[model samples]
Target chain A: MKMISENVWEIPREGKMRVPARIFASDILMEKIKADKSLLQVKNVAALPGIQKFSLAMPDAHQGYGFSIGGVAAFDMDEGIISPGGVGYDINCSVRLLRTDMMEDDISSKRKQLLEELSKEVPAGVGRSSKMRLSREELDEVLSTGAKWAVKKGYGTVKDLKHIEEGGSMQGRPDKVSDLAKKRGMPQIGTLGAGNHFLEMQKVDKIFMPEVAERFGITKPGQVMVMIHCGSRGLGHQVASDYIRAMENKFGISHLPDRELINAPISSELGQDYYHAMSAAANFGFANKQMITHWVRQCFDKVFGSNENMDTVYEVCHNIAKMEQHMIDGEKKKLCVHRKGATRSFGPGKEEVPEDYRDLGQPVIIPGSMGTASYLLVGTKKAEEISFGSTAHGAGRVASRSEALRTVRGEQVKKELKQKGIEVWGHSSKGLAEEAPQFYKDVDEVVRVSDALGIGKMVARVVPLAVLKG
Target chain B: MKFKFFDHTADIKFQAYGSSKEEAFKNAALALTEFIIEEDIKAVQEKTIEVEGMDEKQLLYSWLEQFLILLDTEGFLLSTIEELKIDGNKLKAKVKGDSAENYKLTGDAKAITYHDMEITHDDGWMVQVVIDI
Candidate 1:
């Protein structure tokens, strides 16, 4: 195995490490890592109890709460540490795409109208709520049942669930979720909360792997697509907040360094409870995106006249922990895998993949920031060998929001994007400034790193045509 | 002292400039608390609450957030702050507050999150407090 490549370095298992740690990046990315403590966070994850194989970092790896963003770590179910930071505040923060038969030429003239309609139909901004406010019971059901809750409510078709990761519902107990978390989530079922979340209208620009593209049903170069990037919103935030506090004190019980890295053994009562609650919130996030997908279809119908021919490309959650099975040293073992700011990249012929896509491999949807190109990629078998079947999520932030706002004005960024023919919509100009294209690293570089590492293979490139931000 | 308002992604921030570090921190706390409760400081009476911290900066941050939390969750309108002292990393502050007839809270900030939070002194005796959204 190429443990240390041109930019990557592997920390071999020693002392407390149960497994090695592999970081995927170039020297340039590593320089950025040195400026921050994300590498230290990755190293900390390697020290956790019962960690398996390797703690992997994608090209976009950066400093984050407990586990660094773009970090992937797996642990045996019987022995492991589960920290809220590993999953992050936005429980199921994920990406969803919809492909249409319509071409770029068909929707060029209606771009502004489409953007306006989308902004109105999709609730956005901080504390934004949908027209449909659910009662406490309904909220619980949403958390417990996930996208199935929305489909049953007639928000979408059952077929939509098939294309979603874990069928859009992570099966587990919801009663473990706190009442406060339930209250916070009750009013925000389909809302798109602010900060880095967005809805972008795109056109298939180019095909890289024709075989994978054909399997994913993406053929024409100008075919229109819509991608929604969001998550569990307030409910998930509350869950994380409540649990971080719990862990802060609970980790004291177990005696771990760094209060920010507070955690409990996977078998502990506190850990099990947090996992159940986390899973419920993840479910809520799944249902939240599914509901928004329905409204997206409605927005498309308003513009294109009908959405019956539109199809869901895929829905995948990047911030989550899952119980999975992987081979370690030629022995198959069950492990709890934490993929924070990383996507599951199960290769072709995996059972978890949908029947239609089993031959094509899991679809890895990576949405670049506004004015940048998004991508569709397929999982590779090498990912299992390197990163426990995980890949980079997006163009990780290089500059903080404030840094972006200081360097780029919202109106100017908007002007530049418009000059490029990208239609943009959001609650405020200030919000737009925080998500300026300059705030992020080049996603093309991130994709290249993953491709070079053989974790994922690019299938298609998508350029934005219309955009919505919160 | 001169204070400037800045727009954070999810919160409004204030940067205060002063000849002394103590003044900078005190004013920063005042600015943040004032944003939570819109009221005239002259009209409110003063009652004090003491807070201690492990470090001077931590004490400053915790002191401000503690007061803000009281104002946010308990509806306490702070009027004045005094009796501040820092010995090594430890700090002690006596915060003054009084109940107002009616005050409206504008934002729904649950708590001061520690994400990317920072407090630093600039070259011109200006102190900046960056709060995570």
Candidate 2:
């Protein structure tokens, strides 16, 4: 590995690697990133045909199945490939931030009550299903329109849709999704599935860019916000599984270095079908977060009495491949950018950003674990040039789920969190213990690297007051 | 219950052991069951599933995926693999479990992965696999 800049390191294109693998991390973070096989996975991604520029690993990069979480790679539409592992099994695993007019002091007394209401209002945990079961046609609408279905269902005003990525809906082909995937997704519409997914009530502790922060509805310190983190549920998983199997069948696995890295050529019919189905599943995810937002609004009103002025700040998904145009070698090229565990950090003037915040740049949300600090960042133009408009997703895992379970008991973690003035609600003790805050890398440092790299600059910081885990 | 867990950085990985390949596959199902739910599962009903694959690994993946399908579609919590047979690349199994609502499930296993998956025979058969939870 060679140091390209102060915070950037590189593994020059070697042997089978078609492109160099670049990692954005400080010297200390580099050590943790190198602890696992994540960097080697980056090298492997670099070897994939038609990958553009460099295969990049964000600061929070950690070992995942095939492609490391926090890995980003864009591929040529005609010559490149799209892999299921690259997009991850959980399609559109995303985060949504709702800014509230109320402050910390306002909710201090009723914090636990609010959490209890949220815990009831929003379905969570493994095997938990919602009362809202969608029929084939209704689900097809959701798969095709994404969160717009929620808007039609009156989850939030049309203004709320504006703040979401891709207007909370992609051009999804519901026809491409299988009946099996649809059946799996049906009862899971408003549910928050397990593993690192949570709903946290947070308070603004600090603000770095007061000007930009104000524009994002963070007018002052001590402001309260709600962060929802989840994905498309079983439907998305089945879609990924179905496609992976199909790809393996169509193209023999003998050539794949890692079976999990199975891919179909982006230009192939099968690939297009997978992309459409994947987007439909992504739409399901959007509709999901939107519906959750509706229930959250109701819960807030029921608890606080006045629910007016609560609005969405921004929502972003870390998984999925997008057909985007980027300047490669000073020439614009249409590419399929796959961000496994990376956030899009597109800067100001991008048409994709909401109209209200167009001039100020897109709002990038980075949520921390159980009882930690989450950050809001301003996307940068420099990010588009250097890292293909991508940044780290979260405080990447430092220890395995089993390792964390061995280290601490759930009761102990809850007690520790209570000492920090944070309340906890979770489905199972083992699940809580598995997501102990210690298992994650320091998010502050991760954000620092992003800011230093001029990719996604920090705007405001919020700490959790209450956490609901699944 | 002839299975034990191994440390994986982000997800769960396990190795199931038995006297034969079929038994190893059955043990893998039990391992999956234990990982998802902590409570004792009563086999009140039985359901059968069949899958075909071009190779052994795909066969294993297809076979294990059926449990997840049952869980998602019918809310069936896995209790046991009552009977199993692997005829070349085709597999058929009878599984027994109660409705998932009867138990508290811990993990939402998204899919099974082929990462470092191995089905080996050395005296007793051992099959190692990782699941995306």
Runs in model 1 lying further than 4 Å from the true structure: A1-3, A12-18, B1-133
lDDT tens per residue, model 2, A1-470: 99999999999999889999999999889999989889989999999989999999999999887798999999999999998899999999999999999999889899889888988989988888986878899999999999999899888879889999999999899999999999999989999888899999999999999999999999888999999999999999999999999999999988867788889999999999999999999999999999999999999899999778889999999998999989998999999999999999999999888999999888999988889999999999999999999998899888889999889999999999999999999888888999999998999999999999999999999999999888
Which pairs clash in the backbone of model 2?
none
Q: What is the lDDT of residue A210 in candidate 1?
A: 84
Which structure among the candidates has the greatest TM-score? 2
Model 1 Cα shift for residue A282 (angstroms): 0.7
TM-score of chain A, every prediction, order shown: 0.97, 0.99
| Model 2 bad stretches (over 4 Å) | none
10 residues in a row with least lDDT, candidate 1 chain B: B103-112
How far off is residue A325 in model 1, in Å? 0.5
Residue A414 lDDT, candidate 1, scale 0-100: 90
State what share of the real interface contacts each candidate retains. 0.06, 0.89
iRMSD, per candidate, in listed order: 6.2, 1.0
lDDT of 1: 0.77
